[model samples]
Target: MLIKPSTAIRQDYTGLAELCHSIDEPVVLTRNGEADLVVMSYEAYRRAEARVKLQARLIAADRQAGDPTALLDATSVFDRIRARIDDAEA
Candidate 1:
């Protein structure tokens, strides 16, 4: 993790932005010696967001798997999905 004082960004915004793009990781900004904000490139932020969404989905699936009553056969699941797609198309 890269840590920088809040003044660093104020003094060199372009340079800090370049650093974020080059490193593809978050830069922690400190204010008064305490953590203040996180700065990251847009692409990195998007990837992080997608990872969080995927993790949530996996957790939901795991919980559902532990409940036998929630289970549905693959064929029925696919058929329902296909029917939805067909309906949308129509």
Candidate 2:
């Protein structure tokens, strides 16, 4: 969604918040016909931040370990998670 900065400044926050939630994506806030800021939901922002942190952690681990062989198989990780879920459900 394209929003003018002046409109954003003048519009009611509740309406803006509703628009952000309903869109489920970043709303482009424009200034002078140019893109300026992006408005996104708090939940979306949190999820994105979590993903970025996870990726950063993985990258750091890779740099420190210096060996791909030390990593567990993806399936093994999923299997462990499944086991934990099953145990919790039992």
Model 2 scores a C-alpha lDDT of: 0.81
Please count the clashing residue pairs in each candidate, in the order shown. Answer: 0, 0
lDDT of each: 0.98, 0.81
Best by the lDDT measure: 1
RMSD of each: 2.8, 7.2
Q: Mind giving the per-residue lDDT tens digits that candidate 2 earns over 1-83? A: 54646367457777778878887777888778888888888987898899999999999997868877777788999999999
Q: Which pairs clash inside model 1?
A: none
What's model 2's lDDT at 7? Answer: 69
Q: Which numbered prediction scores highest in TM-score against the true structure? A: 1
